[model samples]
Target: MQKAVGIIAEYNPFHKGHEYQIQQAKEQTGANIAIILMSGDFVQRGTPAIFAKHQRTAMALLGGADIVFELPSFYACGSAEYFSSGAVSVFNALNSIDFLCFGSESGEIDTCRFLGKLLADEPKLYKEKLRSFLKQGLSFPAARKSALAEYLKEKDIPFSEDFLDTPNNILGIEYCKSLAAQNSSIAPVTIKRIGSSYHETSLSSEYPSASAIRRELIAAWNTQKFLSDTLKNAQPPAVKDYLCALLENETFLIEDDFSLLLKYELMKNTPESLCAFSDMSPDLARRIYHHLNTFETFTQFAEQLKTKELTYTRICRALLHVLLNIPSDLPAISPAYVRLLGFKKESSSFLRILQKNSDIPIITKAADYKKLLPKEVHSLFEKDLFASNLYETVKCNKKSTAFTNDLQKPPIIL
Candidate 1:
């Protein structure tokens, strides 16, 4: 029996740091294969990926993943809680994975587990503190941290709430919480993040942040510089070549590309109606409606709506829900099927093992989804198709290329 480690990621643009993580994961766990559950066209940050999912999948396979599966768009674009729950649920349902590995600022699994337990079982004092902080107008994240700090202080727990301040640690805690909530058997592991901070915008380090790489790519694209020059040391050789080839022929997408589509969605809805979308609140809906006349681009609108209570990423996510017509009430948090994106040819036997062990269907062909999935699950799968086609349409329109519907495309067999 071959051991496998499960990784949840957005590999927005596969870089050297990501390649290092995959290598380290396999070595640390002594696993025969590393399976990745990655975000599709849209990521958790409420924006489209800088590169399309298939392109990114190719990069992942080349970088060292044995198999890559798409995390459904609903969860991919959701908050940390939803994203972690969805990914952990899929891993649990698979029943063959041995470990769930993630990167965090603090590489202590026990601390993360303790915090996860505290959060999952929100004690009375913690709840009251949370509400009191919320009443004082702190953002949900800030309020939660403050409440946890006070509660832990009273309980005489020595752990610092400062761990929650880092993005990866926060997400790692959410993963722990989800694993505990589902009573999953998969063990959790962490690798300390290296080189750069999550939001750092500098490209000087060997393991530059993805945000920095994207910013550099955008700058180079605008100035007509080659990707090789811009990302010479930041990406793995294969990924760099793949990206260079992609940019030579296709248009790389950015948030502003969907500005017109978002504007159209906004034009058709009222403040009351807008509140029906995921992450949309009464206040946010009103603010969006009030500022409709001043809207320019998706990025601009999100920035315009940002406030002390609402962070910029949250605003972007809410606006994206409106643009994509995602309802506030989702049918299920757990994914119905595992959608294969790409895999190495040598891993065919491992793939079969996964299929044999998985409780749900493994979707390789888009056209066969209706036959393989339940009615509700089929409907959920349709959103992924719609999102891909919409992304293709925008990309094609921008590049003056003919529209090739991605629905007919099968999983990439590397």
Candidate 2:
């Protein structure tokens, strides 16, 4: 038996369900160690996490994972495909990771494999039919599922949404798809999600959604008012202090640190130039640019400009692509390196394994990265710069004007 298991996650705020997943992954695999690939300050849904990376990493460590690694912003904040690919790459680097574990709507690996195969084997005509359906008014996801199901039906492949529309399942499919594509030896597995489908707002005593918890925290509502019976074993970190730091003046990150660049990109740049980043279609940009002045914030702006088929998250990702100039080709080639944000003592062994087996360089510290890598690594540092700058710009009380202060400054936590 291998010494470790791989868990790809974003502990935006740890809760009962996640705890269950970690324990189950361990139980199912009979592996002693869990290597978690986590998103940094930003997550795939393109939002600042309620808690910072260190805190989340700390929570995972406190809960049970033997090691934690950062999933760089380049991959962390992108679409499902990129997120899965990045996690898969990191886990693949760790020859110790015998299993890649995740939570899904349906835990059936065979069904996931079937859908994963069809998506991988997408025929030329299938794409054409999908595009035509998009023209007739189907959303990209809807068109994709429709086209995929038609292909599956023709091939007599059995599959179901079992969870596609919900957020986690969508990413789960991508995970399976990525694993299949990479031909990784690690096995794919899923733990069916427990309660309140992804984004469900009401907080239940037994199975509250992470979104609900976030909403309560954002509203400054007391956790005692919403803590569930099942969550007794969960024990997330203190929320008040964390949120205070987030809402406080000059704490960690600021509001501008996030979408400000995107806002400016939308207002100042042309649709042609903006099309280069992740999922930035020209038509979407045309709509976004016109609505720029009409709304104030990204959320408001997306609300004002979004078509029925395009979700707020989808449009925001496009806008982010415009801001970062994240070309699709760039992710395909350049994001070969995985940046280490923060980790605990056990990570030393995991790092040794990664270094020994990884085909790509594993960057452990920012200062070292700057000294060793070329200017392109700046893309990675630049986003951090943007985060600091945006945070400063939004939180006026912060005295320091430097956005790059923490860059090459914050070393991995031992």
Candidate 3:
């Protein structure tokens, strides 16, 4: 049987570290193929990707992926738990994957799996403890961590809070839990994240965080400097060239890059209408409604509403959904189809196998999307189309890419 390993990612812009993971995953698993289910225009962080999805998809192929699929917007913009489970569900539905590989700060498969099992088990005491923490006003993630720690202490199982703290480690644990919940046959594997931490902001390291790279790239683009010294040194040769070329014709966007439009959406809609989207608590909605005229940018608005309890990222994501008019109930549903972004021409055999074993519809040609999926699924996909159009409107002044005409843009064949 042919073996393939799956990776879930938001190659917001592919970097050296991502390339390393792909090479390591393929070599470690000895898998014949690597399939990456990547986020589309929107990402889990609740922000638009710096470059468009097709551009990033090209980067993924250049970085060493055989196949790349879009992780529908519903999951792409969700929290870690929902995002991981949604992607895992898609991979599981394929029934052709042999292993799932991801990068983590800890890099220990056993430790990650143990935490995953505990979370999935969700013993009685853990639930009580979690509810207690939630009642105390902690964020959902914090409450879950505290509850798990207390549960472990009661069981006399020593565990470090660090396991649940770091960004990559938290995501790794979620991947394991999702696999367990689905009773998936695919094995989970981990690679130690190298160079910089996820939140690192400096581009001095060989492998800076994606955040850092984006920061430098944005600075360069803003100043009419296509590739700054920092970005040139930080990225791999091909990646640096690709990004520099992209910036020459397009813009470098941040998480709240489209905040002006978001503000318009918030100001144009009733508070009640805004409440229908995810992460919009009544209190948060009221705050947003009252502050609509106070701040000029979405980032400023988010910062104004940000508190110890309400994080900046959370605020940004919530406002983004409002701008997109995304329904709050999206997370309740599974992704409707596997949207193919791009793939290597040489991977025909692998693609054939995936199509044969896949349970969901595999979308290749964008023009045939309606014909391939049900009306309801197509409606859900329209969210993706809407997101693409919004992102492109920002680039209207810049040169056009494949993303400009996503409705008819075929998947890139490299």
Model 1, TM vs. native: 0.98
lDDT by residue (tens digit), candidate 2, 1-414: 346778888886766677778889989888777778888766777666656676676667766666777776667778888888878877776566788888887777777766676566667867777888888887788888777777667767665643466667777778888888888888888888886767877665455677766665544433334333333333444432333444343233322345565676666777776676677777787887676667577667767767877777787667655555566655564355666655567557666776788766667765566665667766665665555344344433344543444454453454
Computed on alpha carbons, the lDDT of every model, listed in order, comes to: 0.89, 0.67, 0.85
- Which candidate has the top score in lDDT? 1
Candidate 1 residue-wise lDDT, 1-414, digit = tens: 699999999998888889888988889999989999999999899999988899889999988899999998888888898889999999988889999999999888899998987888889999999999999999899999999999999998886777989999999999999988888899999998998889988898889999999989898889988764547688888878877778889877999999999999999999999988998888899999999999999999899999999999999888888877778876255668989999999999999999999998999888898889988777788888888889999998989999877678778888
- Residue pairs whose backbone atoms clash in candidate 2: 254-391, 256-390, 257-390
**Candidate 2: global Cα-lDDT?**
0.67
Structure candidate 3, residue pairs in collision: none
Once fitted onto the true fold, the runs of candidate 3 whose alpha carbons sit more than 4 angstroms away are: 398-403
Against the true structure, candidate 1 has what lDDT?
0.89
Best-to-worst lDDT order:
1, 3, 2
